[model samples]
Target chain A: MLQIKNLKATIDGKEILKGINLEVKAGEVHAIMGPNGSGKSTLASVLSGKPGYEVTGGEVIFEGKNLLDFSPEDRAREGIFLAFQYPVEIPGVSTTNFMKTSLNEIRKYRGLEPISSVEFLKLMKAKAKLVELDMAMTSRAVNVGFSGGEKKRNEIFQLAMMEPKLSVLDETDSGLDIDALRIVSEGVNKVRNSKNAFVVITHYQRLLNYIVPDYVHVLSDGQIVTSGGKELAYKLEEMGYDWVTNND
Target chain B: MAELKDKIIEKYTSTENLNNGEPVEIKHIRDKAKEYFRTFGFPNRKMEDWKFFDSKPIITNDFKLVTEKQEIEKSVLNNFLIQDLKANLIVLINGEYSKENSQIITERKNLFIGSLKEGMKTKPYILGKYFAKYADYNADGFTALNTAFAPDGAFIYIPKGNLLKDPVIILNILDSRKSKVLGQPRNIIIAEANSDVHIIEEYYSIGENDVFSNVVTEIHTDENANVQYYKIQNEEANAFHVGTTQVFQERNSIFTSITLSWGGSVTRNNLNSYMNSEGIECNFKGLYFLTGKQHVDNHTLADHANPNCNSNELYKGILADESNGVFNGKIMVRQDAQKTNAYQMNKNILLSDTASINSKPQLEIFADDVKCSHGATTGQIDKEQLFYLKARGIGEKEGKKLLIFAFANEIIEDIEVPELKEYLVNRLNEKLEKL
Candidate 1:
């Protein structure tokens, strides 16, 4: 579903992602575990076409098209979703209105008619339950005064609503408690299908236990040093990242 | 200054029977106001209150006082009316009341809706009691000028214990097609004890020729009265307007005002409210969106004179394409006005690098037991908020538009009238689309 060839990215004249390459197929979950400042979040940002990141030398192909040619909004319209590590608090913009606008824009890009108000309400209700989001939260301003767990759950709620082709969970489990982690991981597991793919980026092995990955890759010092099956995650959890970095 | 002063004196003295059938008291007041204007001529940047606003163009331009009423087609007049509002419409053309175009709800007793000149003839006692009482001619040059040339405008009076079934829509239309014209519209609204009323005052210019409007409105609220007032200014791009609104609140009275300015070459608004008695509440809100070399200045004041009075003030400005805006708000708590609560905030967003704003929120509290705070903020469109919206598949234009709308919506949501709120929302959207 996605391919990266020697992905080299820099920000402010400092190299972050140094010749990183990875591949993912349909219906598979891939876990990219790395220490702090190891370019895990940079990979997610570059793939999502975030501003202020200069791609020095690399190419990213998604679904048989070069993704670098599209703008951030166009990339979003092409079904690339990046759940932000910290969702912005937008006062005076209700969550329901934001979701409706986003959904209609995406639908327009796909050559589909706008959803009716009744159907939109029903969809919101159904998807909100999958993430256990309270209906009252949707009526308030977007993420204003929301707790950490609620913000993460709202991201999952958006994921369920968009139903994108490729989803990048960028540290989605950083601030979640045990209960919230279970609920968020369960929500992600429910949304997985044969036509979709996910790149779960985290710092710990706790989330992989809930949403098991088919492959695990160790990212250290701006490159992927080791790639193996799920057992690699257990080994890293048992012996920490030094085991792989020293071997490399 | 001398040339303009001589022209104004000639214009005032040349008119015949200017105060026909008026009492000697009103004539004396008019004479005093004229003397005040002659002494001040026009305010300059040297004055403290007039430092930010320059009246050079208004003073230098040769403006003919519009004495004769001009003819306007009914179709043109209908365009200025609020189409969906079921309110009493009072239309003034070239500073004169147009009887043929006005509609008054006459079934309600003790509700007066007509021209100020006619009101002077019929209800001279009430007009004389509160005509130029609230607005201080000595403090402001524009107020003094408007009072000196006070010819004709809307006169609204609601009697004691009466509730107005519909709002009063006062539309001032200027037809400056033949020559550069000057218009002074004086409005007086008095709500008696235990009464409720809503008034919406708007301005429109039909022709491209320069039109300078000097308007003053004085409202008096008796004990336990409630009044909601709105001022909408969307004149032509070449039009210059200076409007002053002074409201006086008695014991336990409630007064709220919202001033919205969208278009004009130079627009200056002075809104002041005096809380004379205890347990009064005064709220002032304003929003101005300017583009294309437009300049708007808003100066507001809330005077808490008695004990246990509260006032809240919020003003927002959005400037784009080299537009300039200024906001100066002051809250004063006198020595005897203990337990006073006053809050003031002014916020601005500049869309372009060339656009600028000067905001100053001042608070003077003499009473030691009062709680008063004021703040002002000026910034550009938040980039993180913009990126958040754009990353959700919304285009850059739509993203910026949404953020701007959201910023302005905080004030729009405070409007109590549904129709007016919806109208403002549509107008704001239209303005955002152009930006």
Candidate 2:
């Protein structure tokens, strides 16, 4: 459902993603493992159409359409969601209000009627329970005083609310503890379906134990240099990337 | 130095005369005002308050005199109407009261609303002593100039031992048609002992011509009386507005004033509150939201002249684009004003890199048993918050707009009036939609 070829990107005159190629089909979970400064986060940023990123050479196709031509909002409307590594603390903006506006904006772009208040509340309550988010947190300012784990859970809560076809989790398991990691992984697993996909990008193989991926790819520098089955994650955890990249 | 002073005095004399035809009253206070204006005719960059926003533009621009009366159309005046405010509406076009446009409903025996000229001619002794008594004319040059030309102003009075349930709204509409206009719309609100009332003064202009609105509102709160005053200045972007509201509270009285300035190229609001009696309380709150190349300056002073007086001041502003905003708040406690509780806070947000804010909160206390504190904060939107919203399938435009709206909602939440609050929020969202 998604294709990337020669995806080269730079930010502030510094080359990030030199050249990359990846493909993900429907109903499949792809885990992109890379070291620090390996352009994994840069790839997620470019896919989400963030500003200040210079896409020098790249062809990104989503659902058979060129995805690079759309604005950030338009990209979101077309079912592309990014679970931020660092959730923002927007003071005075209620969580429900922010999520409602985003959902309605995407729905409007898709030529759908705005969701009724009753339906929106029902959806919020159901998805909030999936991530174990407090109702009080939903009414407060978006992540203003939330803990690290609460913020990560809030991100997953929003992901379940939007229900995008392609979800990019950019280091969602980095700062999470064992309990939080389990809860976040379970939340992601509950939302997975045949019609949707997820790209879990992380530096460690521990998160894969909770939410097993169908395919494991080793991303060195920029491109994915190695691809294997789900067992590849455990093998890499035992033998680091240096062991694999030295022979490549 | 003498040449600059003479030039300042000559600027007013060389201008076309508007008072030559009419024979108005020359009271002692007005005579003092004339002398003050002649001595310090026009303010220059030398003055601290007039340094940032000089009044020389109003002096250089050829403004139409009060004698040049033009017939304003009803359609044109509709733009100046705040149709949502449920109060007695009085519309003043170019400093002149328009009875045809004013609506007085259910007037009580204690309330009276009419022109200042009529009040001066009919109630001479009452107007003579009380008029210009509250304002510190010699302290500011524009205040002196406004007092010098006190014609075409409003006079509102509430008698003793009566509580007025309804509010009185005065709409000051400056018709800046064709030429740039200069209008000095003065107002005097007097509340006797045991009286209660609410007054709102709104400033609006017609067309986009360069205009200057210099207004001064003097309020007196007697014993056991209460007055709620709201000054709203939403003039056009090309307009220059300077307003001074002086309030004096007697024993066991209360005065609450809120100044909201969202328009005008350069707007300055100076509010001075004097608690002259024991157990008197005053609250001064202001919110200014500026965009484009607009500039808004708010300077306030709360003087505790007696013991057991309390004053609280909270002023906030949100600056966008290349605009500049300022807030200078001063709180004073005299030696006799023991057990005085005063607090002042001014916060601002710069929405753009080019936007700027200058804030100064001062406290001068001579009383030992007083509780006073002042705080100021200026900042931009949190970057992590912006990224968080964008990641939730929200676009950049909607994200920025939401952040700005959230930033200003802190001040809007203080507005008690439900309809006015909703109207302001909707209007603000409309402005944010364009960005």
Best model number under TM-score: 1
Candidate 1 chain B lDDT trough over 10 residues, lowest sum: B15-24
Classify candidate 1 by CAPRI docking class: medium
* Strongest candidate by lDDT: 1
Q: Model 2, residue B11: displacement in angstroms?
A: 14
Error of 1 at B407 (Å): 0.4
RMSD of 1: 1.6
Q: For all the predictions, what are the DockQ values?
A: 0.76, 0.45
Stretches > 4 Å off in candidate 1: B1-3
lDDT of 2 by residue, A1-248 (tens): 99998999999988888888889999999999988877889999999888889899979999998999987778778888998888777888998999998898888888899899999999999999988888778999988888889899998999999999999999999899999999999999999999999999999999999889999988887778888988999989999988667756
Q: Model 1: per-residue lDDT, tens digit, A1-248?
A: 89999999999999999999999998999999999999999999999888889999989999999999998888888988888899889999998988898998889888999989999999999999988899999999989999998898888898898898899999999989999999999999999999999999999999999989999998998999999998899999999988888987
RMSD of each: 1.6, 4.6
lDDT of 1 by residue, B1-435 (tens): 446567888878777457687766777788888889878877889988888897888888888875577767899987777767888888888778889888887446767888898899889999988989999888867888888777888899999998886898898888888888788889999999999988999999978688889999999999999999999998989799999999999999999999999988999999999999999999999999999999999999999999999999999999999999999999989999999999999999999999999898989988999988899999988878777777788778888888889999988898877888898899899999898
